[model samples]
Target: MRYKLGWASRFGVALLMGILTFSLVVTTAPTQIQGAIAQATAAARQQQREQQVRQVRPETYDLSRYPVTDANERHWRNVLWTTGVVEPQEPYVAEAIAQIVSLTARSGLSRPQQRTVEMAMQIATQLYFSNPTGYAAIGQQFLQTVERSPNPEWSAMALSALVKTGLDPQQRQRLGDRLRQRFPQWNQDIYLFTTLRDLALLQQTPTTPPLGDLLKWTIAPNQVHLYVICRPDRGVLCQTVVKDGNGQFLRENGQLWSIPLLLRSLHELSWNFTRGQTPQGIYRIEGVRPANMETFRAYGAYDLVKLFAPYEEGVREFVPGRPGQLPATLTAYQALLPPSWRNYFPIQQSYWAGKAGRGLFRIHGSGEDPGFFTNNNRYPKSLGWNPAIGCLSALELYDDTGRLQQADMPPILNALTRLGGRSFTGYLTVVEVPGADTPVSIAEIEAAINS
Candidate 1:
């Protein structure tokens, strides 16, 4: 294997050479040469300073003094509802999940309570995944669900869920055969047709999504890295190398942003189902919500960039950034990708997820500071970052006195912003790439783009 130097190593070498050249020119070259060399060195130093400034990092805050207010309650409550935990009863599970997640992030979680919460979350998600189409009940319950449910949608969802869970073929089909007989007319139904077509896909051998020439990121989409954030020079994306699909380096107006996001949903359930982890897929960026209109303590001060799944909620509204209309069919949505990544299944998750009745995903900053909690990190890999109800959440730094300081949402919104201050009708694709514990670093992104 060829040995590779990291960004720091490469920079160190370049700095060394620049220093040596400057020393030689200053010591031995004539007056005019020395003056020219001095000017060049100063310009280079200024450029380096500006380049470092472009790689913006959010300021950290101490939140221990701030009390865990109703915002935390409301955030967890929303999570509970997303996980199908809504009821007249208090959301005990949400509390546990929140506690576990917070604890896990900053400090080690060895409490039995942590195990209890994990098991509870696991059970809740399992119940959701298994019952969606209704075969996990087995024997009488399974038969009755398939045969008796009047809703053809339920039956279709059940069969598709069965396919997704790797249920036995013969058993799945036996129930599916009954489902077909029950809903023979459902073949024409748009929702069922879309779902069952996706089910047929499960039977086929799964292919790995291609790492095309574009460094299309499948982020757990955090680390606040933007390849295209700009650098003052005619929109040249200064240092750091992540190329966009059009084979050009991207710029975010000379200011690269880092929005700490965890694609892992608070539910931490299966990706394909509703309220699961942020599914690996491409979504349409319609615009940023000018204001949340709710409590700022949960959502923060940044405007949320709204995301739409293909054919989401049966509406294809107009967007100013992209020409023509929204994609209505799978082929059209595939048009969202470069020709190279069209067949990649993971890249198309938002489409199927939308088909499965999941939407309302947005890119927003969080207000739930983990510093106030004891245990809340079973799912989010980042420190102090909170999970979402399937929305892409960016990190929000606040002051010790409970005031917002820095956020990751604004730059992303800025990147997607269009002429007339409209949000771009562009697409944001998230993929779960291989390599355990691997982050979407600049080198990795460059390698994929160059490859």
Candidate 2:
């Protein structure tokens, strides 16, 4: 939500200041001046990326159009699965599992490389929907990955996988205790702590939100139900829906605005858990990001509402565009709403997730179709609605002549703008409400809203 001078502007200002001094060296040696200018420009750009990263944890592609390369088949496949580009079935899932197995047999790995750890986590997450709770298939094997190095990143992910295995509670507790003792040395790592916290939480049941919490959040302007469970009858479909309109948020002027957020991501991970698909919780609506070469094929042009999770690293200063005195604690996050809402668990999912270290997020449309040719998707993929890592993706369709056929994000933009004007700063609450086995029919949401 915060804006700053562009890198070019900053560089220009610095150059102007330097020119005003009229240095003899600058006048005499053009090459040195050019090199200095280049260095200054490079430094300013890097600073900008870092600053932007704190508030908006955009995909690298979003930042600078970095394309996924398949020079390394293992990495490419993992990327495909992680990005939801490919479904978690057949050769894709099988091959990704094989890559993790292969990583184990290799030698000369005293410590896992950064990419190695990251790719492993990526595959491990999607593996949940594929393997379910007892992630037994990949747990022990990846534990070896963690044992290879005591590094926190590897340790955090490996331990996360291990906790899902049949590890005893007492043993898990002791191990977790030991790790926390070592945390201070690593500057009291929050990711490590929260990662383990998620492990412990998975072992227990979540506190059920009161009915009012579910009702209010269901009709909230930017509601998204991204947590999904695959049932026998429904396959894998979103568990929440609305009544009057399939997906609309009512504005203050009493107008029914449609943002078309009928979304689905079958990342079996539960509410508030970012270790899964899109998290359930409060997010700050921080405007949009137009499509780039890396994202255009999947996400279309001039769209994408950036959702900033509270407590997200670098976004500590951002209070979601909700009313109330600004407070930043996990409990304080809910205080932005009415007193009655502070106790709402479902609406607070993302606030917890941000504190746990999953931050950069968005609500955008994708042109990619997971079920265009093959029915790889568990349920029918509506409007080419494919999955995104942790984003709430909507349908944005176009016709042959590039005429807009269907688009959902623009309305979402309008609704948020109505709530927060040009900055489009508002709170987006994602929750996992009732209903399973059957699809959340349009009637059900309408009934709920009307009542």
Candidate 3:
């Protein structure tokens, strides 16, 4: 049986013990426990050797001052909640105000606890969107701590959290300036991706457009935005761009993959239920789905994916009935549909007239099996290209062992959710540019980035 890491308890007490024990082993060990003594001695020697070899401090931080507050009850609760401690009574989301107040008291924190504190701040940021003035003091305190910390892990978490605190433009500029100095070079790190996004937004100088022609479609002018640019011929090289309400680019041209299937043309939405041709044109994301039984049955785990619609241009609205109660004409089409595609609900419905065989199209993970969508061995190995029926493309991140898994998607999904908010209800325009049959060139992507 494949061992699935339980999210709620994945990094719980056991992890804390391991961290604490690792710290203890660095200092002392009893000679009675022969095996543990040998291990500890060797680990201590290795740590000493590493420390001597480099002036840079070790990656780990001191968490002794963590759970950073006087109120022990609320501190542990927020910590457990942040760390995914799954207990029935200990719900994930308590009152946002309580979490914010609890976090305010604490000062010195390790990288791990800083991350927890960041999560708490995020809850407050999302909750108090209308009135973020209440969090000004908390944001400043957290910002000062992050600014003082030299550890990259802690600084990265703190800086990113500071952005979400809804700090004023001056504060955002200060954070951005600090980030630019720290992360001078750019790789595919998502944290840096978000940092760059906030930097651009804070600057807000009406700079050059990031996504080029894709910007034309995303002109709705909303607080949250997602631009999915599909290059069907390029397969895995689709680009997902995110922006704040003021049209400032946040995440510029991040890598995202899609179903490897190619469309017959730019206009084709889908051919069948299973072998879907990615539809072109604009679609609005009306719903965000969490993992459920149906999802688990289909993908081996409950993964989050946004449901988009007007499956194709002018093709909106299901037949006037419930899921199974399709009209006679629709029923005929449903009989020919694949089992997986049947009974899919619309996140966004349209009342337009001309309707063809277009239904569910979502941006989802690669599921439990990396090659599950492509029959385990039938597809290309490029993340640039994967298989999707008629759905917009998505990615399931690689695990620590470098294997793709469904569970790895949560972090990236959370990033998207953070950009769009908890509900993530917003405009999602999917633009497909045709005639470029070759895989998306690196030059083209770089141009998008620099633009």
TM-score of each model, paired residue for residue: 0.53, 0.57, 0.37
lDDT for model 3, please: 0.39
Worst 10 residues of 2 by lDDT: 1-10
**lDDT of model 3 at position 242:** 58
Question: Which 10 consecutive residues of model 1 have the lowest summed lDDT?
Answer: 229-238
Give the candidate order by descending lDDT: 2, 1, 3
Please provide, for model 1 over 128-174, each residue's C-alpha lDDT reduced to its tens digit, 9 standing for 90 to 100: 34243332232222244456656554345445444545567677657
290-400 per-residue lDDT for model 2 (tens digits): 544344435543357776777654442354244432366765666555455566544565666676667668776654433331223444423245555577666544443
Task: Report the C-alpha displacement of residue 252, candidate 2, in angstroms.
Answer: 13
Q: lDDT per residue, candidate 3, 3-113, as tens digits?
A: 123321432332333233332222222332232233223343355334433321112111343334444445544443322211111112233333443443456665555
lDDT for each candidate structure: 0.45, 0.47, 0.39
**For model 3, what is the error of residue 235's alpha carbon versus the real structure, in angstroms, after optimal superposition?**
4.0
Ranking by TM-score: 2, 1, 3
